[model samples]
Target: MATRLQSKWFRDNSRLQHCLVSDPHHVLRGATGEHVSLIQGALSILDGSRIADDEQKRHLYGPTTENAVLEYKKRRRIINLLYQTQADAIVGKMTIRRLDEEMKAQERSRSHLMFAVGVSLPEPRMVILSETANRDFVGWANQMVKLYSGKVVKVDAATDPAEEVKRIRQAVNTAGAGGLLILSVGHGVCIPQFGEQGTFDLAPNAAMRVLGKNYNENEPKDFVSPYYDDKPAANTGLKPLSQKDKDERDQTPGAQRRLKNWALWQEVCKIFVDGKLSAVVLLTCRIGGAPLFLQKIAGQWRTKMIAYKDQVGCYQTASGRFRTILGKDKDKTAPPPPPHTNTPWGEITIPLSMTDMVVIDPPAAPKTP
Candidate 1:
């Protein structure tokens, strides 16, 4: 688990030694890290700039950092309340204090962090959601990071899946007894049934590149932008995992513990946050394939959960409405079943929204005459 930025503040912080402040006791231009990096971090949180967290370059009060400081002060009206003046473009004492206070509150709220598939949703929009989900994830997050301008940690869970769990649990613990609506978008191995939801065998993730859009910090309008990173190739279809390698990894206890929900979300909910979440929608493949899986999960959670049992895709309409489409689903989509309380998988609900999303109290099957 990462230490909250506020925890990193306070007197005698070892990292604080990198940057220094003068008589006015504020961080300004030309000064580099004694705590300039930390100042940049706080400004990023306060103003939602894509400032690099803890990097050496972030230690300098560059033009971007200066602008962020100005924006943050303006937003908070961090004027010298005593003098009733306007905000300025400096990390003075008031700005630092305000940043610290804001970050403290931020760490205690619902926050977002993600790494996208590519930078943006691909063109034509016929591609499977797996290819585009991360793009949306990154896009939504980018928009959110700026709009809300909270403490957003930009990291790909692929490198440190455990870290994500820890971070989530910490955020949940600090959210002050409020329910969270969670939407997770990514690829998952389709589960045929409930008990067979093996996390490891299902753990392989689609290749993840750097922090997306070449680290584009700006929020997007329609989640559509040119890919600054390596664009995804056409659907060559997934290469099957070999049996021997799968067996070996599954046998390892440690590997099983680090299960990826791109198969089952239970590992994180049960182990980390203990159901602090209210609603969870996993936009992965074949989640609805096993009705019993969601049934078991719903019994545990207080709020609703939703998921798709089909290999989903994002389709953009001619009028520019981007939504999940039934046309793209080839095999993973389930067929509509007989009218009953127990919803059978297959037969998609038609023109679904956003990456064959699933989870929640699915509508009860209608009563047959």
Candidate 2:
């Protein structure tokens, strides 16, 4: 049923061409004679290749040809299976120019891609930071990409946080998605920056742009503050980093200059305001209850930012210790495991609060014309 042009596309890609000709019955009637010659050519190519003996050669090539034939029988449901299979070969070729333009024109105007700069610890060492955590985060992130139209890239555990943030911002800007998401986790410190007039609290502002007026402004002046009450609304018990911890943190490789948790959190807020992000989620302690100056944005109070002070340990430790806890249950049948689970570390769901931001949008509406 393929048109002449479509059949030609399949023939151009060697692997897909081989697959198409593997089964005589599935190929177009017009290509039958060519298909026979193709088979002869393949046999000739194999004749000179590295095959120890007739028996081994026959065993390998025989099943490969047979499997291809069987698989093609079911591939006919595809509207343009040949074209889809050959898309890569013809990507830069003239054949797809019109189709490619039309496809780009139809894409959503909003950007779906987001980027996050995550830190496991202040110094990138001490405490418990592992490759296992990065792998786990990447796996969950890929699932999120599948749910959404755009991709999500993470920069974490970088040797240089400032440079890493710069690269991430550039990539996301190039992607031009509707919104962005940024998450940073590590030790939160409060420190003073020496200035012309007086000392100012230094916030996290390396390689950050778009949260305030111009791109690359480091001051944390424009933002909103959430009022922390005695009652536990989101249950994140946030507290300021003590002076002792701040001094110790300053000695860390990346923390030579003292940085406050509030300042670091504000960079996330800028993403939403700069039209680069629809939502931003911070997975650190004391982010929600930051001081008034740090929290005020555009002369209004902004409180949606959720911060769980000292809760990262809870999530990681809970899942890490799941094996022990489940064993203690002593019940015979275990419940179903969480998605993409580490056998030892049960399934992970971003805390209920952050799940809303992670959900993917549904596919488009059918053509109504």
Candidate 3:
């Protein structure tokens, strides 16, 4: 039920004659009549000569006629360097005005639409854990940012979960509205409860440990410091933990630090669900049961969500191995395969305009995590 403009009525009314095109003087309509000939003549004049054949011009304003008008508009736009003109496939006054303008002048002047290409427009933003800022992840994030002309914000692994959420909220606010927010998390763990939606934690395993001389005997030996290797020293002796110490360590405030996925979603909704963002891409592992929460929230805010279904590989392959796989003498100028082939990963997209979610099952293999 799109609104249609009655160009014939406007042409008949003297009051609306000012809005009609003077050059070629035609009232274009979507029906079969003599007005179609006038439209064809106007299109032909705009093209600098006759474009449509006589037989085609005499026909109704069907798909072929519409396509011809569109082709003429496209060619004129290219030749005249016009950017702001709408390509509505209709011969209107604005189209006539654009055709009358000097091509040289169009080239010399920048359209107001062209001036706002990258500036003052919303750009994608990313937040990643410092612990997971490996070479592969950082390179991939940089590539995505460049691809979308976006911005990136890094979250420190050492920051408390609450403070981390605050930092992320601040980053989303800084990113502004009408853009995508990519949250790349690492070492996520899912905690499940019976008859309840599970919660996903984004705390890296390396952060759940005691550091330096402040080692707790109750803490698990499985915890390793990311900064240094565990080597036996004369002053510091590694000892087995007692049952009491283990219980105490489990109950410790720091030991229980984990980012709840639901809580993270709530925080993100508070900051970004202002009906401004286009979408949120959650690039994390084991995003189980979170899509439901996201869908409910997205429905309320009229935003979209893109979530991964399983673990995404973020580590880079060795240089030697990579070269072997791609062949050392491969042609650099050759085009890569199409993106829709050999699907492996899965993604779910919840569009703002639709009630049902769209699931891209086994989508093209991810180029980067």
Judging by TM-score against the true structure, name the best candidate: 3
The ten-residue window of minimal lDDT in model 3 covers 341-350
Residue 276 deviation, candidate 1, in Å?
3.1
Candidate 3 vs. true structure, TM-score: 0.35
- Model 2 residue runs over 4 Å out of place are 1-133, 146-157, 171-178, 184-276, 289-304, 313-349, 353-369
Of the candidates numbered 2 and 3, which has the greater TM-score value? 3
- Given candidate 2, what's the lDDT at residue 252? 58
Query: What are the per-residue Cα lDDT tens digits for candidate 2 across 283-335?
Result: 33332333222333322212122232222322233323211112111221233
Which residue window of length 10 is worst by lDDT in model 2? 122-131
Candidate 3 residues lying further than 4 Å off, grouped into runs, are 1-135, 145-159, 187-196, 202-268, 286-290, 297-302, 317-369
Cα lDDT, model 2, residue 223: 18
Best-performing candidate as measured by lDDT? 1
Cα shift from native, residue 230, model 1 (Å): 44
